[model samples]
Target: MDKLALTFELSYYLWGLLTLTIPIAIHLLSKHRGKLVPFAHIALIKVKNSPQLNQARLTQWLLLILRLLMLLVACAILAQLVWSKNADTSANLVLVSNDWLAQSSDAEKQQLFEDLNSSQNSRLFIIDGLNQSLSQRKLESKALLAFQGDTSSTTTPPLNIWANLAEISKTLPKAQKIQLYTTNRLNQFTGQKVAITNPIEWHIKSLPNTLPETKLTASLTIVSDANYQQQLLYVRGALDALATTLPLDLNIEYLDSSLVQEDLDLSQQQSHIIYLADAPLPTELVNSATSIISSEQLQGYTQADFPLTLATKLFAAQTKQWFADNARLSNQQITELPNLDLVNQQQTNTGNAQSLHLWLILILVILFMTERLLSEWPNKHSRQVEGN
Candidate 1:
């Protein structure tokens, strides 16, 4: 657990001591003052009328002691002083998180889950929407359900991460350490305690060499599904990643909107056409195009030519295979391919084990044990002195 200090916590024990001691001292000292009574044989009266000996004073002292004990208990809990000897010693390894991102290819997600599966004594917290649960399994054999539906940012804001971390700390024994496996998205979170030991950042960069305008090309086509009337489709490719945004003359395309936002449903055979005025065909697209139609007939396509091979490779890839094999097909086959710069890359690294941190936690447990014993020793000595 991350330690945070409350300003007035230390003062509670001091207050308790002062409250009890001041009253006791006053009562003891007051006895030294001599007093006179009008009645004869007042010694019996003096014994009965002693000021400190009362049920109310005893109750007050008991309350002060109880308050002090309560404060110490609270402090111990806040400090996570309780350590479980039987807790899994292998490594606390609380799954910081496992999630999917659009930036990652379908293959990357599969490999990532595999890596998580391989970690021994590790818990899995799959972040689909919130976080899904899975029984621990072998890394190689673990099967993860592919993330489907919209790949856009989550609708609601992510769960309170700090609160999640706090809860995780409580669930595990104080002896065990913690680790996080969050995506780059969580890098925004700063100043976290619980010792983030090793965080691996994933970066996927696509290197695209500009194809000469002379390299053969074809028209940019947008495909949609039967249900696409409710959704918007935007044709995004490598050019968007390189520069600010895709550079296409929307005037050539006589469509409702040139800007596509939602995922394009190529499941059904619906296709949107773009017309170009003076743009030459991209090498990838023209080579893949079965029939090249007249240029004047096209109205809404971009004047800037895109590669034909890039389009064919992208459309033929798993993105298209997923739709063809899984998604329901329609009668109309999409012929005009969108400008696509498909990137297929993987990065795998083995993490180094950290055992020194475990030793540090052990030292802390010993310190807490020693402190508890020492605190009780003083009380025992005080009682012995009183008995003597």
Candidate 2:
């Protein structure tokens, strides 16, 4: 955890070890004094027998002292009193799943692949190539060739982002989590606002003078019949380059089996536009029909500087992917994702301080009661003197 916690834990250990000495010392001293006998040389020895030195009294004191020491040692062990470096020997494996649906272009996909490949000891699973099953197969090891064009699944499957994530989680080493890369599409899911606990870091190369917030927008139109009557429709959002083009009056049906029609039209600036017609759609679809048409390229989103709307979107996508992978099995498990070290450190320090305070109070109370008992002890000599 933190230095504070480390210090407190060490101190408790010291206290525990030291406390053991208290009972041992008391036992040794008590055993030695137990042999002391009263001599008949009364002229040289005028000291009176103290109440604390009686055999029964000494035995009682020794028992109490030893009991206290035992309690202290027990408490320390439960508190993790030892300073250890062995805990760090544990290594964690995180499986990262990347899908082609989220990639804006070939170049973007390549860049994303490069990022994923660069990670240390990560297993990559690519889901878009020639052989459907083969393309979706998980890749093991660090070979660079396996990452480029495996001639796998040609058809892009419906984005089963969560299910794919769950598969990755099952493949990963137990106790390790699977990390899914998703866009800012989470807002459509959970209605709650979002915060950036952990934001992806990107060092974009060959970007077209685009700021982190740069976004491109496209409008789609739907025509139901020859009369151009509007109807319920579904729309998917996605992005393409400036030069890339799609055919006009394109006919595409939604996966929900809705009788919707979409037409791609060029904007005044020659940008692609999506048109929908006779769209039989449901408003409460699980996945967002709206695609990440304009993937907002950015440097980074931070906990302090990121917008709530964007954070919500990113959180939704990431969290959804996380759950699909069964990685969120510990969703209720302390999710201080970004600042784990800081949070753990704080908790450990607090626990140690509380322990120390409790022990100190116990010691003080014992000492106070011992002194009061000694002060009020009865005098045996005075009783004998009065009777004579």
Whose TM-score is greatest here? 2
Off by over 4 Å in 2: 1-16, 32-69, 81-139, 142-144, 148-388
Q: Could you tell me how far off, in angstroms, the CA of residue 374 lies in candidate 2 after the best superposition?
A: 28
Q: Candidate 1 — what's its lDDT?
A: 0.36
lDDT of each structure? Answer: 0.36, 0.36
lDDT of 2: 0.36
lDDT of each residue in 209-285, candidate 1, tens digit only: 22222222223443233333322222333324313432332211222222222323311212223322234444433
Count of backbone clashes, every candidate in sequence: 18, 23
Candidate 2 lands at a TM-score of 0.28
Model 2 residue 142 distance off true place after TM-score fit, in angstroms: 4.9
lDDT of 2 by residue, 65-164 (tens): 6466556646564454433222111222222323323324556556555766676544445433223442255655343223443223222223433333
Against the true structure, candidate 1 reaches a TM-score of 0.28
